[model samples]
Target chain A: MFDLPDAAALPRLRPASSRPSLGLIGHGAFGAFIHPHLARFFDVVVHDPADSASASLASVAARQIVVLAVPLAQMRGVAVAIAPHLRPGALVVDVCSLKVAPLAILAEALPEHVEILGTHPLFGPQSGKAGIAGLRIALCPLRGRRARLAAQLLRRGFGLEVVQSTAEEHDRQMAYVQGLTHIVSRIVLAMDVPPLELRTTTFEHLTRMVDTVRHDSEALFRTIARDNPYAAEVRERFAAATAEVMERLGAP
Target chain B: MFDLPDAAALPRLRPASSRPSLGLIGHGAFGAFIHPHLARFFDVVVHDPADSASASLASVAARQIVVLAVPLAQMRGVAVAIAPHLRPGALVVDVCSLKVAPLAILAEALPEHVEILGTHPLFGPQSGKAGIAGLRIALCPLRGRRARLAAQLLRRGFGLEVVQSTAEEHDRQMAYVQGLTHIVSRIVLAMDVPPLELRTTTFEHLTRMVDTVRHDSEALFRTIARDNPYAAEVRERFAAATAEVMERLGAP
Candidate 1:
């Protein structure tokens, strides 16, 4: 299911020389990850302003397939900056946790001729530290050649399990998947430390999540809570459920 | 720290004839586990009322070491029933997750001459399905003998790490460790299921915790919430933290 366009359908894709070079904008952790794997399939043009002060934005936008790997908050600025220089018929992909916001930013900022595809490489620096083989990546095809280019590159190139999803469905599920998880971890870390001896195996397993989001930048944690539309509802439900459990047990 | 009594301390314990016969009461899942290991060190007599309604409580109490593996709520009645029959100088061990309550019940219900030892063998059937070499079992020595028998049986007999602690400290630490874990899991399971495709490595780790608490008996869960002194406080703090995070995100 992940490999939607199979080997038989490969013939329909444009030939090698006609295909676009991968334009990887933003050189953060995710950008660094997608670049090398992207290079394996096509020539990669990287534009990380942080590393090169005078980096030419037009050069990166000129590529046929561009990946937006900037922080979630920076999507708008980056999309607007590179919109004018994006080549016609190019596919601009986003690698953001929450799809709806980034997809909207990319769709409105880029020219009508440019296509959009959204993806969330669920693994990060630590999890993807080894390699991304067998890892999960959500693919939301927005405006484009049915996301054929993005699907082909992610599955065939990186050996990732591409779960085809909608921008709405991706954000809805991530509200609980990423939103609830990060909320619990961030809060638990904020609490006083429990005695080490009382940490059971299940507790150890639960805290692996604490380790997952523990060192994340405050910006990323806030983005999961604020950016996802369904996050508010999920948080309210989680808080309500916890309150009910405690109330049933009576006060402390 | 786990191996409190090294090999040198073994000599301080009584010999085979001087050591007490193991009398295991309430052959529940945990009781069955403790029986076999007790048999390895001493003769064991099991009296499970569920299996044999006419089970002679006197026979079990007559032994020198009687392990009360009854449900948390049943501890008081079980102790009262066997108190009169308990052999002189015998040690009654209560294996309950929340130590403060059970320890109090056992100490109050038993004869003053009857020694009390409280222990929580932190692993369950599923967790200990494999070898339990590195598992932890908290030993809260109460009334008499400093719980040397239980310490030796758990550490040397079962290859477990015995954490020597008082009932108060064990219950205190467990409030955050177990109370928060069970509270989050119970609340999560109560909520609507998120899309399965969105289960990441961390989410999968989290759901493992849910699985750990899912099949647990309602009586057990209620005890975790109601019996432990710190459980209510931890649950309140967790609920408040969740609410604060939602408010900070400006979400409902």
Candidate 2:
């Protein structure tokens, strides 16, 4: 039951209650950025694990929708804390960058009755600062009515293009997307700022790009590069391609 | 002599009469785009070798100023064809992407009496279509009064910022500027275009960048990579850093 319809449908299927009570669990940059938007259609309540322990998380499970907005490293702990309280028919979701890693934690930690969804909001606070009306969010349906709700909320309510994919396929796509950009950026920033005289628009634009992600936490960089199963192969391809280009230039 | 004059000297230097009759040696995209601008300030003649042969080369040497507008690969032959015809007083200039390589060819191939100036206009016809009033042009004075004249035309007339540097310094700087960008762009373009649903704004911008340089001739790519002496070292650094990042990502 997805919103994938035909000719007049042109795209997807399904229709459910558009607005559901959402229990958001995290208040980091991304979490806070999307809070106001989610609050529009959702009877929303946010829980920050750092502020107070199980008490805050307890408030989330009773709601119709529970979203885990914590970091990748903290997924298992978050899943465990909320699993007990999520009763039957309630949907749980996550908005992490990598899909497979966090979704797996949710499946292993949560009970069978708790329906689940995995999402990766492609833009962050900086990119979304202008408003994320036309942004992209990858949606992977795990179980129950919540997947349809995610598609509706992400597509209709917020105007995001909800790209439907499985957790494995999402991770595979991200290996080149999230994985390659970060790797290329990191490698470029590791060098000193090139002198002013030599700078061109292309180089200047690239430097500005590096500045945008300069504050990305080391933990996040390490996790993305290491966690996604497909990253290693993409990295090898990058290396081989780089070598070939250089060899074509006659580099020994 | 650089063009760093005080407040009263700001308006200009050397009267318009000091500008001599100009001869443009190629009429490709850049040459055509700039021909009208060059004509605005001086008596101008354009000779594209592809269109005409010895006669066009003959027309260039008699002019007070001769500019090589040919590609990097064609610089030596261009210089040779014009060498015997250039008068002792003429100033010769080249606007190749890699300044050192073509300037060296110009220096060796042309007669000693023909003064040389190495330059790189940092924008292309596409970028400059909106009028090139505020762009940058690197100026490396190799001989005579030609460099100052170039700085004047680019600055006071066309509003280009002329960064004074040596050919070696220019090449060293461009090793990262032109070298890294083309390499990064080429590598990114080598990957298949990701599906539309999965596209983010950043990815969209990167794809557009690939489009910008997509039509770059293979000879242009190879000449820039191989001819610039400092490019090999930069390529090596990029490779080493890429490997280190992939290793940190846990690649075998």
Candidate 3:
């Protein structure tokens, strides 16, 4: 169970420094993808328990902001372990795909003295071949006056489109949009037809999607599909649609 | 009730000249799109059934090639009506989305003396904006030596990739690739979300698809989705998948 902060009681932590020191909890593809851009705004410290120790991230821990870019399933444990080492009053936020689950986890794990916020970058690292010029970011405020400020930094400094929504609403919509789209793409890829056989514009479109999620970690897929309570419902709906269509085609 | 040539007995046709006179049987968006390009290959003639008569099509019937760029449902009827007027041994072809049905229609409707073939340009008029450089054209051979020649013109003259396949197989696969993709895209468009609310990368992808088909005529959509026998099966499978996902989401 998590102790969520009241909307009215959140803290406001804004520093006067030109560049904030930032600690990142995951160094996976998503972490590596956003780190360089984020480094322009904040001094970045990256920590991945699966890859590195707390001592490794200590050098960057002195920064003003801490960012958790870990898998949704591991977010809680990493937040708890890193909570003690974070600098006092450092604004902590996450870039997880699902908001509600991680928001709950971070709220429960972090100390009351620390500020917490959650964010979801709408575009995958693989999506931006050019750069993050027109990408969107969803910011879910948990317990901080710094939440809006942190979101503004992402928007103004980095040119990200920021949308504010509750963690629950974000998860509910994501279940339909992200989860179902990925599942459909996965099913298409699993069919394993040769590229030459796929000539239709529609097949080409589906191929783009399959390519998008092909590099994602299995853990990431599992977390998004299973950890989010709304995902199962979305997946089930897609499966039912597939089944009915197959039945009409006399397909098993 | 439609008479068609034996699939196994269909003969290929050869191109008549380096610059053949071309007759276009429809004057709608697709016909207009192809008209300018046809001018490069033949002395072009344009006819629209709603506006032009058989006598007008016959005025240009002296051309070596006649391209039926009309709607799929009207393709057979037009072919039969225009057959008696075409020059002997002239090559007649169609640009319909469905091959099997139209192939049969042309084979039965055209005079035995005139060469007939069915061609599906695996692209739209919008593709003309880039020129036909790397696009694909599917050739479904029906009668005469015109089929082989048509393939050559599509390749050597316009620089399109030519794919040869039976009309039945083409329609079967297109049901899944084209029909299902269009159906899903329409569903997304029908969701009626305001443009301001749709900011996600996934939604952007879906919107691109919706935009592609939005300008297409309802007859084209119906022909691709309903008239093509294989489409029902493919759409059924896709609809089933969507339903399955929706059911999981507990959508009523």
Best by TM-score: 1
- Report the C-alpha lDDT of model 1 over B30-133, residue by residue, as the tens digit: 78766666665666788988887635889988887788988988998999999999877888888899998998888888998878889887877667667677
Residue-level lDDT of model 1, residues A1-252, one tens digit each, is: 112234345446456664447788998777886677666556677898888763478898887777888888899999999998988788788888888888888878889988888888888876777788899999988896747756665776677888998889888888888877888787787765655666777798778888877777777887787678887788778777776776767743
The sequence of per-residue lDDT tens digits that candidate 3 reaches over residues B124-171 is 765346676887778888887656656766776677888998888888
Compute DockQ for each candidate against the true complex: 0.54, 0.38, 0.19
Q: Could you say which candidate leads in lDDT?
A: 1
Runs in model 3 with CA error above 4 Å?
A1-20, A39-43, A52-63, A145-180, A190-194, A197-203, A217-252, B1-20, B52-63, B125-133, B146-149, B156-159, B190-198, B217-219, B225-252
**Candidate 1 chain A, run of 10 with poorest lDDT:** A1-10
Model 2: how far is B235 from its true place, Å?
1.6
CA shift of B155, model 1, Å: 2.7
Looking at model 2, give its docking quality level: acceptable
Least accurate 10 contiguous residues by lDDT in model 3 chain B? B1-10
Candidate that scores best on DockQ:
1
TM-score of 1: 0.85
Candidate 2 ranges beyond 4 A from true positions: A1-21, A36-44, A52-55, A146-149, A155-157, B1-21, B32-44, B53-55, B107-115, B129-133, B146-149, B156-159, B191-196
What's the candidate order when arranged by decreasing DockQ? Answer: 1, 2, 3
RMSD each, Å: 5.3, 6.1, 8.3
For model 2, residues B1-50, the per-residue Cα lDDT tens digits are 22222323445544655545788988887788788887666667778867
